[model samples]
Target: MVVHSISRYLLIILSLFLFSLVIIECKSIKFSTSLSPKSLDLKIEKLTHLHFYLQAIIGGDHPSEVKVAGPNTSFIAFGTLEVEDDNLTVSPDVNSMTIGRAQGILASADQNELAYLNVLIFEFTKGVYANSTLSLLGRNQIDVPNREIPIVGGSGVFRLSRGFAITSRIRFIPNSSVVLVFGCYVLHY
Candidate 1:
């Protein structure tokens, strides 16, 4: 029994000593004030797979659907938004971003509703880019059905984003200037 007790006591002491060493090493780790609260080591690499495919309907002269506000010359225009994923084809599913709306005070008609200053905040589904409304501006849309627009800025996940949008008119109705199908591809970082 004496030998047993001695061995047990030695084992207990060894464990206690190891525990103390662990505690000491843990306390020795000093947090430096110079270190950023956010991990400075956090690497920011562009997510190449991140892409935006949207179909925008520019509201023309529709009594209820399209309302014209602000100055008579520079009217506020609101339109619908539909966003898709990798499939460039605009076949929207339940998971697809849909029923989105975009509104912006139109610039002078002299600018043909295509002005760098004509900005529209487009809202859509999901949390990623939902916090901040993505902003868009018309770049070039003269006689060409294909127009390149600018993504001036964004909010939420897309905050401070800068990119361009290439839009091709899939359909255009000049009768009431009320309908048009545009294929918009927007890429940003």
Candidate 2:
């Protein structure tokens, strides 16, 4: 009988000791300064995609000299965004760097419905020189379908749990006859 009681007490003590240890570990905390106390809200301004396919046939007129421009041509989307009252800085997605023109445009519409626009043009010449056999390669220009557009601005409230909210306006330009389909995912910090 005495041995049984002693064993019971010992078991209780062991359980208590393990429970306290778990509580201590659970109470222990870690700190990081990389986080910001401020809150933010984000929304999508605009997202669009355009597909172009063209085939040039050599039939009636073959000039004495051959001329080749870029392999193909297409326009990209460009736009500006206003986020709430806070100042915003925009950066390029390096992976999006294209061998052809990549355009970014941001536009604003006033009460009168007049649009003011800003344009970013990335014209690449890599494909143009690929086939150098042609005597004359002309400069190629890719323009956005709607060169001018209205601006889109939005806001949403976010807290510590939400981390950062990102709204983006992205466009893709393909310079080939083959159908090119692309999907993009963005992660925010």
Candidate 3:
């Protein structure tokens, strides 16, 4: 009877000790304040306007765009995904001044309309913004004129870049290729 009592006391003491440990751990957790943009000394320097053309060669022997995964029904079928490394040029002509490449995946997310969820990186290889990249994530309604896409972020000279790209279909060669003009207004440091 005495041993039983002792074991009960010991179990109760261990339970209390564990509970105290948990309380101590919870009390020791320090909550930190999130750093604000101003506290980080981030300043918006300039609003730069960039104009370029994206030539997506969808067909031919060496195409820049390829359908990666999708149903066999149609190209614009919902959930269809295509990957592209389209050339960025100064003009609509593919042979114009080569500046960069728009590399990303385009997914057909709309069933009723020809809309694509574009997640692209505009990688500049020439001119003043060489070696810089701007990330774009937005919906592109192909039928709409001047479809706007948000420039979420960037790297290199385009660090902390935020902007919108006005994209318009310049030319569309049926089953061959499509040329799009992108006019971006970016605000960055």
Among the numbered candidates, top TM-score falls to 3
Clashing pairs in 1: none
Report the C-alpha lDDT of model 3 over 32-77, residue by residue, as the tens digit. Answer: 8788767757775799999999999988899999999999997788
Please rank every candidate by lDDT, starting with the best.
3, 1, 2
Q: Which lDDT values do the candidates have, in the order given? A: 0.47, 0.28, 0.93
Q: Could you give candidate 1's per-residue lDDT for residues 84-174 as a string of tens digits?
A: 1111222333145443545553343333344333456666554454444567776444445656677777665555566665554444444
Worst 10 residues of 3 by lDDT: 36-45
Per-residue C-alpha lDDT of model 2 across residues 94-126, encoded as one tens digit per residue: 234233332333233232332323332222234
True-structure RMSD, every candidate: 15.5, 18.9, 2.7
- Report the CA-based lDDT of candidate 1 relative to the real structure: 0.47
Q: Estimate each model's TM-score.
A: 0.46, 0.24, 0.84
Model 3 has a clash total of: 0
Candidate 3 TM-score over all chains jointly:
0.84
> Runs in model 3 with CA error above 4 Å?
1-6, 23-43
Superposed model 1: Cα runs more than 4 Å off: 1-99, 109-117, 138-142, 174-189
